[model samples]
Target: MSLGGRGDLTARIYRQIRDAVLDGRLRAGERLPSTREPAGRLGVSRDPAGHAGLREAIARHAGVARSVRAGADDVIVTQGAQQALDLVGRVMVGPGDLVAVEEPGYPPARLLFRSLGARVTGVPVDDEGIDVAAIPDAARLVYVTPSHQFPLGVPMSPARRTALLAWAERRDAVVVEDDYDSEFRFGARSLEPLQSLDRAGRVVYVGSFSKTLLPALRLGFLVAPASLRAALHAAKRLTDWHGDLLTQAALARFMEEGLLARHVRRATRE
Candidate 1:
């Protein structure tokens, strides 16, 4: 995939290697020069975690807005929320692993887990949210849209949130919290996200800017626990290396200047 950016020397070299691989000119298992030389020349290592500026902005904004506890290093930028889920699946799911999704949940997440060779099961959702008791014991990953239940639009009650986290800890499973569209709330303030409430670091909080910004921008991020950070970073590198740095830089500036919060406030009022 084209990591869209200005054609710097590094970008040109990356493109050459990419083209050669795609054209079958660079066969697998062939040794090539290490990247240390180019990395030294550029004065920056190839970081799969994504743009530093954007990750810092996301950490700062999410800390205040979502009550999420994280640092810039904990954030992994993705093409969108969908890609965040994909990376999580890549790290956590294996063939025949049990994966659970909320009934009538986000279809994309369900399909994603299934595509990763997981045995997907749907747990029932009530007004409070997905019934923690209904989740399978063997599930290795549970995907939930707790802030605003997908298709049902009900915020998970605080009690339910606590129960779900406890369940995850007891089951030794990970929870994927898709916080998509929670920024557009029109009623009471959103309950604490599972990420904020989690003490065991089992929640992978996934968020997207598609509702707040233009969907075509394809910006999103995930706040992963320390335990999964390395695996998630590796998965991201293998998937796309990184995203469009130019867009990430623009978004970072927008957030750092407080324009993003201002836009959200105006959107909420309207």
Candidate 2:
């Protein structure tokens, strides 16, 4: 970092900028000064792009998109759920927006929402999960884990589910139902998702194959409301275009033949 008297100032400056971008200190589409200006500031010679290419490389590793949807629009493959959280926050929440999240839920979700310029309110969670009545007065989105509440590990109550749907309908708040790790439930009869019971067209279901499939799979899904499905699908498209089509086709066959169902049922009832 001292340049070691070898005049490697460009590499050092490149690294500094790269680290900031990768660490979320510099977000997607955030502008970097011209190569000459930074070099002047750093007492170095002029250059081109000021490591914009390196910054883009850092973004590629961070999995942050240049565009909101990132040009893929179909299936998004993140390094992990955390990166997905970052993506959702970056794309979904804007400044001064209100986003409702579960109380005592995952901290990273809260961070992601806040990072996206949302005023995040924590909705209380009971043994059965988020208390829909605890939702704030005016919120644009309700992000929940209706299938399996994090840490607490209890599915939302049926009545509360209906109540949430009603609330979303009245307030026009989009409901994002994260069914993370639902496939590995250790319980009785499997419960259907709030997405499945969405009659009001407000629920968006999200799931990851991290638990059921290999860690490197990185395949997650967003089953949106009929109205939002197109947009979110476009979001997915712009993000990565689609998951590996061959893998999806093969998995579709496996699921249709009852492979995933049997696996879920067995995992739950075992």
Candidate 3:
């Protein structure tokens, strides 16, 4: 029988034995090993946890390359940028909380916010990015792809970026800056990241290796404010315990050895 089949049988047998013992049908000195012992023998374990090395590497890269000041403590390794979004939605968004997203934005983000009971509002986007003036006054959270607006490919202008941050501060709102494709710039100088421009701790920067390296890797991270770091880590732990350890370790080595930078340079030139 397959391993799964054997596991099922073992569980059934263990339950039966427990019931027999409770009913005084089995002897006190039973020879059966505990369920955990057998599971351990089978090499099953809890979900993979995030690696510290990878988190540190990510913090270093973001600080050095993207001008985002993130420490390992402020980073949460997620399955991808999508999960980072989900985590933010879970922790920060409450029922009926207003969430403003770009109007033709990434569909998954809108759906995810809605699933968490947020009243997601679509704000129109133009060449300058999501129009800050159009954001609802009651919005508690704003999600934007400012580095390179999704699908439309327009970078959020510097003036608009400042306005958005100011609006977030005035409204007591949080801004989720999805820096998904900022690493591969074509010609123009990269605009300062919203997180870097943020002085009021309102921006949560989300990044993914999917666009830069490979989507199959499903590796991404969130650079949250010091205040939100604990809650984000708790949310991450509840959702998936952590991300894949092997992939994180490998990616950490790739980053530390400068392999990722080299690859990006080569790929951008091509």
Candidate 4:
């Protein structure tokens, strides 16, 4: 490849490694040597050696746009919302941490927390959502699907929502709001997230675009208190440097243009 053509070659290599990581060929926590070292080791030129600028290029390619405003500092992009949850589990819950979850919540959330050494406590759910009174004081993190409980199509009631938030605050516990299908509440104005009520910094809200967009998009964000955002971001960086650059770019574009909201609207209407 010529000097100018090296740009295209670099993109290819970026995608190759990125795909490997995403595809399970390269598992999380696997170390990757310097790009140049890999190129040299593979008998290739340095054309594919520089990845410093690859992140931005990939972010743009993935339709992500950058912005600053309400809840900006707290959001960290991840491979997907699943990884975001995993990151939350890793950084927020230590061994034996009590995790309160909806009785019939997303199976993955419970499993992930358990995998991280958390003691999962199942709280009964109703149309109103997870019962706050049932929550154990030992729980450090309360994982709930407030907008809509998974598979049950249950949206937690207003009173229950308020009570849940208050419960989290009174205990100084962290609430991980899985706003997974929030965009699909359908026909009425969307309900405010539980995180919105968190003035005491006890809520760690999460959002994912996997449902509205393609599953392969693997895009999501976590809105937490400023104090914990840095730790979560550090965990994110350690997990995947900065997530898929191109995917982040594509999602940013989707967010910046309001296309994402439109798509969600259309889906909800249909």
Best by lDDT: 1
Residue 174's lDDT in candidate 2: 81
Listed in order, each prediction's TM-score against the native is 0.85, 0.62, 0.81, 0.72
Tens digit per residue, CA lDDT, model 4, 1-270 = 221244444555666688888888888888875677656655544421112233233233222222212333345666667887898898889998899888887898899999999999899987777889999988899888887787676778899988987887788788888877665555564567776666778777676667878787776666567778668767766667655655554455455456766776688788
lDDT (Cα) of model 2:
0.61
Pairs that collide, model 3: none
Candidate 2 Cα errors over 4 Å, as ranges = 1-92, 256-258, 262-270
Write the number of the candidate with greater lDDT, choosing between 2 and 3. Answer: 3
Report the C-alpha lDDT of model 1 over 1-270, residue by residue, as the tens digit: 123344343465577678878998879998664787656766644758887778988999999998999898899999999999999999999999999999988888899989999999999999899998889899999999998999999989988998999999998899999999878887888888899888998999999999998899998999999999999999999999988988887788789789999999998899
lDDT of 3 by residue, 1-270 (tens): 222233333344556667878898777886765656645655433222266667778999988779998887778888999999999999899999999999889999999999999999999999999999999999999999998898798999999999999999999889999999878887776887999989999999999999889999999999999888778877887888866776776787788788888898888888
lDDT of 3 at 253: 73
Candidate 3: residue 77 lDDT (0-100) = 84
C-alpha lDDT score of every prediction, in listed order? 0.88, 0.61, 0.84, 0.68
Off-target runs (Cα >4 Å) in candidate 1 are 1-45
lDDT of 3: 0.84
lDDT tens readout by residue for model 2, 1-270? 122223345456777688889898888888886776776778643311112222222223212211112112223344346555555555567898999999888887788888878999998899877888789868888888877788788888888888998999998778877767765656663466776677777775555667766667555544444465344434544555434544544444454455655776676566
Once fitted onto the true fold, the runs of candidate 3 whose alpha carbons sit more than 4 angstroms away are 1-49
After superposing candidate 4 on the true structure, give the runs of residues whose Cα lies further than 4 Å from its correct spot: 1-69
TM-score-wise, the better of 1 and 4 is 1
Residue-pair clashes per candidate, as listed? 0, 13, 0, 22
